[model samples]
Target: MNRVTAWLPDRIDRRVRVVAWLSFLAQTIIIATGGAVRLTGSGLGCPTWPLCTEGSLVTTPEMGIHGMIEFGNRLMTGVVGIVAVLVVLSIWRIRRERRDLWTLAVVVVLGIVAQAIVGGITVWTGLNPFIVGFHYVASLVLVCVTAAYLVRLDAVPGPRELAVPSWYAGLTHATTAVLAVSIVFGVLTTASGPHSGDADAGRTGYNAELLEHVHAWPGYALFVLTLVLLVGASRLRLPVRRWVVVLLLVEVVQIAVGLYQARNGLPPLAVGVHMVLAALTAATMTVLVLKLKRPTATAAPAGDAAVAASAR
Candidate 1:
């Protein structure tokens, strides 16, 4: 049989790369628009799901600006879904040959579906803080997945081996764990804060001040851990140095934004920036962690091999 990729885009081909970038970009933008939705008290702009409201698929005039914002977000979701579906279909030629790429492609599309379901849950619960927090966390998870897919796109398909010393690997894992803790606390802190997506949404009973410190401690700790990773990467001359540096830069800005909002009564604009930076931080960290390994070696991709044999 002929090579399928002769007519279809390969894993790292221009079309696939563009679609992947769109997937990543869409995930990032949704977070920003989503923050706008919550901060502007338009979470319920449509006031119902699957139909926006009972028997109505679109926002009504009564919903006003809130309706528009929410409808815009829903439209964005459609965009994300279409892009995600494209990613999966684009790699059909290599789906069996390049499990790494196709698997991620599949996961991302499925994640978009799962996220849509979670979004519905957020509405059904009347923006319950815990459910809302879970919803944000789920979106962050998808961001991480999309970030990972983007990073892997730069590498060849093959088995991978640890490319660093054992201790260094341990440090990276620890760093990731610390980052997780920081993010979890940050979510809890937000749940306890004034921004609850809607005026009727209830907040957690925790004291915002105390939870803020709880969140800050882990964040500060994460920064320190990242510094250690950066230093180690520098001393060892590891290939991951650039990724670590990028992760550090994101952390710096994130922390500055966090501090500004903590003192300024958590203005909606600053808070939205903080949310965006947090996603960036998570995404960059994901890239760094992936950089820890390299393909043990490279071989001809299945499509290329097939084409060469066919020519012979």
Candidate 2:
């Protein structure tokens, strides 16, 4: 155990940050790829769980391109699992000291496991819109969590001090709330729309056009709220102003993509881009939240026993 500990860095460093970035990137990539699978009508190419097909661990020739795409997506889970294991082990020696790190690492791994099960279920249920929507939303949640983990890695431990006024914090919370509602409506819009993963896949039975408009309401609200936050941050010279700018940019681009998709009758490429931007927007929001506060305590250097103890 000591040798293993010695082999891995006992403290957070560039290598640790690299792993953290990889964790975030992996989730984002998976979201994009999953979008591809659905847009391409490859959701059920393999037609079975655990194995690509019944009694087969790989895609068969008859399954064609769809099978390859779906199987490729399944294989990505293994890649993500490997990265999660690395993240856990890399920080194991400091697990007691950096409880936050190890705990989040475990959650990332467990979340992946749960996602795999959900994927299987989605396939088994013949891509029911609700379950499929849940699966997509779950991926966004994982992206958000991973983004938080990354932010925390660089943060000093202890209660964070607010960088902006208390009301600004409240505004931030409200923005997050509206963002959540918008995401839910967006998911519903997709569930009721034309891209049902498979040809015979069940839809949510709601009017897609109506859901689209409902989704836009909260989205516009988010944009206006975020604009207010940005102007306020800039005037106050708040450190989070930069992130707010980023958030606004993402929101604008996402809105554009969404508009294009709708106007074009929901082209697959536009939908895929919208999905990617949605994940990116979620990550950016997490960053904005973290940026709203500064750590109250100074972070100790990597090998300090006092730091280790405090982290515990």
| Count of clashing residue pairs in every prediction | 0, 0
- Cα error, residue 7 of model 1, in Å, equals 4.8
Best lDDT among the predictions, by candidate number: 2
- Model 2 lDDT tens row, 33-130: 89989999999998999899998999999999999999999988898889888888778776876787788899989999999999999999999899
Task: Estimate the TM-score for candidate 1.
Answer: 0.93
How do the residues 1-312 of candidate 1 rate in per-residue lDDT, one tens digit apiece?
Answer: 356547676445778788888999998899888888899999999888988889789988888999999889988999989999888877777688768878888888888888888889889888899988887887888889999998877665666778788898889889888888988889999999999989999999999899999999989988999899889999999999999999999999999999999999999999999988988899998898888887664543653454454345
Candidate 2 ranges with C-alpha deviation above 4 Å: 297-312
Q: Which candidate leads in TM-score?
A: 2
TM-scores for candidates 1 onward, in order: 0.93, 0.94
